[model samples]
Target: MAQLSDDCFAFGGPLMSIDDAVGIITAKVSAVTETETLPLIAADGRILAGDIAAPLPLPPFTNSAVDGYAVRASDLPAEGEATFVVTGRVPAGSAAATPVPAAHAVRIFTGAPMPGGADTVFMQEDVRVDEDGRVVLPAGLKPGANVRPAGEDMANGVVALRAGQRMRPQHVAVAAAFGLTSLAVRRRIRVAVFSTGDELASPGASRAPAQLYDSNRFMLMAMLKRLGCGVSDLGIFSDERAPLAASLREVASQHDLLLTTGGVSTGEEDHVKAAVESVGSLVLWRMAIKPGRPVAMGIISGTPFIGLPGNPVASFVTFVHVVRPTVLALAGALPEALTPKPVRAAFSYKKKAGRREYVRVSLRSAADGSFEAVKFPREGAGLLSSLIETDGLAELGEDITKVEPGQSVGFLSYAELI
Candidate 1:
């Protein structure tokens, strides 16, 4: 549904910073124009098509915030305990039968509506019931201390959830509370995914001694599904320019976006760049990031295309850093959710200047009760096991050359990305 810009790689030449790349994507990609109405139960993880305004205030009435005695603060003794006649009882889901009079208290339960003249509540434990049907109160109590004002959670006619928001269980609960049986959400994104390499074989299938089972495609499929895309796996394509070109054009015509892992590098077997260029145009390639330097962004017949690296770790890292935001932008949500967070580094490390790096790291509990990121024991784009073992990636910026222990650094969690 989104189109690529003509000068997507105009800034900072061929190898661009992560911020610049994301900026171009955020600016060029337009949200899908289609929408659908679905039942509230079916709207989980779907982007909201329109803003949800509160039909009426939440709770709808002023009520007690605790199980206690509701009484007018003015009726209580200023500095000592006092006894009040028990006038009436009001439990949750029931209204007060009569107005609370001075020197009288109403037995109220949590969520019960406050009596007409009662402005404060004393917890049941703080009060004692005498044999004469009177309640003895404590010396000190704040006015309106245990009261839930009308519309406390939400105000009437206010927007409870804005458009482009992904609906979660709590959001569904709000919709249910507003008596909405259904909601309007953006239609699912249509994605076509494939892998490129003669040495890659399908998982669980027979493979040659030199060939390896393709894990990147399955990982891409799962990631796309988690992002709420309607994915179509196009299987694997060999290193053939003509066939791959024809397939790219055909798939682009049928899907909103085409995603492939491998064949962007300048090698003899790499044909994806050539194919995409022959059919459409190559907008950008070669990001300034470690393990994902070969990532490519382009367009085919008005459909956006992203070519990830062949290595599983590179594919995973690039998808989280680059492709994930592009897909979210196409889905009508703001692509700012994946921004990096700050964390402390437990292990000291050194990196070259002018290239950003994401190191797989596990979180360690420090003696001072704070979290520190420790790099994984192993390294390499081919070692996919590191991803499974690490809690997240510790990001070192292009300007940062060295990190000492306990130093604050940026962190990107796999839990948040997926």
Candidate 2:
């Protein structure tokens, strides 16, 4: 856990833009310093603690890139084919006993080390074998045509993977190629997640007349787990100042971050914001965004906290676009992984100026061979099914008010986010 300066609340005057909010979080948040060693098989999704350099040059020796006959380019005649004696054979795992001499060729396979004095490889298709155990070589073949030099893939003593990288499968493969069985990675982030509202009840339990099942808690917990965080579910708590403050203080000491839903707005029953302020500090950021504008970020003791809106769709969207990056930052992962791609708009949309908006859209292939973002028929933060029915969100910028069909727009797909 890390603490921010007391002046974090200084930028508290207006609804902050999405970019400004992200900048603030990136500037103020510090990554967890603790690290642990894990086997390469278990290192996926973990943040690297340090750079990994190649132990030796990749391939370690010059080899043939294809199954061919290793030969000297000079053996081929200037304008006609030349016959060469087949001296020896070399497969992928074995090396030639002696250097190839003039007018002689070595039978070679893919990945076989290139024999000395043989600078080119003629693929089996380009060479003809005779009954007398001789190879007829073609003319005009360039030297080093099918040979892979040592260190071609990676150089020795060079950084193969850098610090703060999230170890993907390909990254792990690189480590394995370098003969590393284990890797040093940042420890899994510990998270405490809860829902705040008396009107919320557990999903399996019978609910009272006006009570709704608590979906945000499970959602937050699953999302945290997907990010490789060690999450503790605090469950649902009533909107009371005393207990809420006490719980906040208790969990602050145990987890690296606190996540809650439903008590960030300025409504009368929204006590989570006040409770956080009483226990430590809270900056209510009325974000200049649609669906989930009321977000609270702060610190208690030293643990960071993020409060999200109660609506299921809003919680999902905010967590994907905002809290996901915050988690990556805290875990020491690269930030570029969160960038969304662009897609053409399939339907027209008109939005108000000064507020960014996200609309659920399913992609449809147009006659022009480009994918178009088709907006879902219904729009509401509380409608959870909207997320299930759509492929992704069509992100509309704050400066843009109207988007016509076929216009390019930034899109964030659930596949990428999840």
Candidate 3:
């Protein structure tokens, strides 16, 4: 864990640029060491702790790609078709007792191993079968046609999956193909999430004079869950310092990461910043990005603490941009794991020069067969409906003073992050 300076909350200097803020967080956070072996059924979405090598070839032997007659290419009749005696039938999971002989064909089904000395197969549609079940080779049948060679899919001792790769359903199939019952993966990081503010009220609670239902916690939890983290909800914390401090101390010892929304800004009712400063260290606050400028990062009792903005849209953006990547890295994921490549902007909007901005935009296809991005009507950070209606966030650089209607800007697909 990294400690924050006493002046970490002082947000006066030219609003920290988005790039600089990412670099700071990347440099400060340390990766966790916990790991475990999980069964194949439970390994989906988990990060691989080691490379998965193939113990043997994927197919393990030459087999038929389709249900057809297997024959030697040289044994075919010169002009039309060559007739051969059907030696035997080989189905999937069965072995051929004897090697195939010249001028002989074998009846094989899909996925069945190709008998030795047979190098090609003719589909049943291409050949005619007599009442006695004997088959005739078709004309123009090429050598090695429709025959799957040994080790074509995967060679023996080949590395199918590299270390640090996140496991998906396809990866699981690869493991099963290699006869692996389980895989070594990093354990899910335990995260404790909460919101702090007197004005915040849990949903279904009686509305206070100036209180609003706290939605940031739900958003945070969803984002954490998508990152494969085990989340512990701490609920909402009042403005009092004692309860907040107790909750922080208790969760710090039990969880690998602690996250909270609200109380990170400069408002007097913001007690999360103060509590973190008193108990732990506040590393950085107030990023240069719009809609999510009031972000906080710190460490408490060797556990990482992320204080997201109180606004719903701001909280969602900051979590995807910052907290998600941090959590992934702490869970032993590679540095390049969370950062997605920028898509070419479909539409453009206006912005000032010094600050970075992320605009919610819906993607549309144009008459010219190209994608055109359209911005949401509302730009306020508190407008949650804008995110729901939009496709993804369009990232504007700090140097971008004005954007033309069709100019290309950096865009991030929402599906890429969530």
Candidate 4:
């Protein structure tokens, strides 16, 4: 946990750029102090505590890439077909007892180790077997056609996975291939979530006049869960200072990060910002991004605080673009692994130059063998239907004043980020 200075909230200057704001939040994030050793089966989606070096080569031996006959590449006929005696058969997991001599071949199956004195494999389909178990090479047969050299996949003593690498299914499989039963992984960050507003009620609750059911919490929780975080739900908070302040202080010391929706703006009823200021420092108040402009980032008694907008889409967008990366960094993941590559925009839209905009759009392939993006009809921050119909956000940069049709722009896919 890291604390923000009181000078963080004193400035009333222009709203910070999205990049600068992200830098500030990430700079204040502290890595978690906990760690755990988990079995390979439980290591998926966890961050590696240290680099993993290969103890043995991936295949561990030179092997055949196809079911074929192993022979020395120099022994093959230069012009046409050649004949050889098939001395023995070697399937996978069995070692060749005798070395394959010149002008002789050994029947080998896929994954079977290459015999000594043999450096090439001819596919079984390209050869004819005579009654006496002789192999006849076909015309145009090339040497080394199907041999897989040892250490081609991985060499011993090589770094298989780097420290701070987030484990995926493929990573687990690689570790298992090296006979690793377990891995040292950083503990998942514990996060507590709540939404603050008098007009906000939980979904399925009766709504009074001018009241709207809270949707940000559910969306935030889903995003956090997808990021492999341990989440605690605090439901909704009222507009008063006592309960809100008490709740903030109580949960601050218990979790690595505290996330809330609403109550950070300058509205009269907004108390979350004030409560945070009294207990901690609000590092950032606003960003130059559309829909999620009211985003706030701060530190409370060493625990990081993220305040998202109450709007359903805004909360989700901000979480994906900003808080998601911050949480990942705090969990000890590499910075490059946090954000995804910007995809080329499929469709064109309009926006002002100074501020960044993220438009929800669906992606489909065009007849010209490229992705054609189609924007959703509704762009409201509170409309859940817009997100339902879109695949992800098309990030319009802060430089371009106008975008014309057929021009490529940056896009962020939901499947990639979430």
Cα TM-score of candidate 4: 0.94
Cα deviation at 190, candidate 4, in Å, is 0.8
lDDT of 2 by residue, 1-418 (tens): 7556555644658789877888788777788899999999999989999999999999789999999799888777788888889889999999988999988899999999999999899999988999997988878788789999999999999999999898889999999999999999999988899988879899998899999888889988998888889899888888789998999999898888899887877777788888988989888888888889988888898788899988889889888767888888888888855465788887888998999998999998888888889999886899988988999888888999999987999888887885
Global Cα lDDT for candidate 2: 0.87
Off by over 4 Å in 1: 5-14
Root-mean-square deviation of each candidate, in angstroms? 1.7, 1.8, 3.2, 2.1
Top TM-score prediction, candidate number: 1
Q: TM-score for candidate 2, please give it.
A: 0.94
lDDT of 1 by residue, 109-223 (tens): 9999999999999999888998987889998898888999989999999999999988889999999999999999999989999987889899888999999998889999999
Lowest summed lDDT across 10 adjacent residues in model 1 is found at: 5-14
- Candidate 3 has a TM-score of 0.88
Measured with C-alpha atoms, the lDDT of residue 95 in candidate 1 is 97
lDDT head-to-head 1 vs 4, winner: 1
Per-residue lDDT value at 341 in model 1: 82
Error of 1 at 326 (Å): 0.4
Order the numbered candidates by TM-score, best leading: 1, 2, 4, 3
TM-score of each: 0.96, 0.94, 0.88, 0.94
Clash pairs, model 4 backbone: 346-373
List clashing residue pairs in candidate 2: none
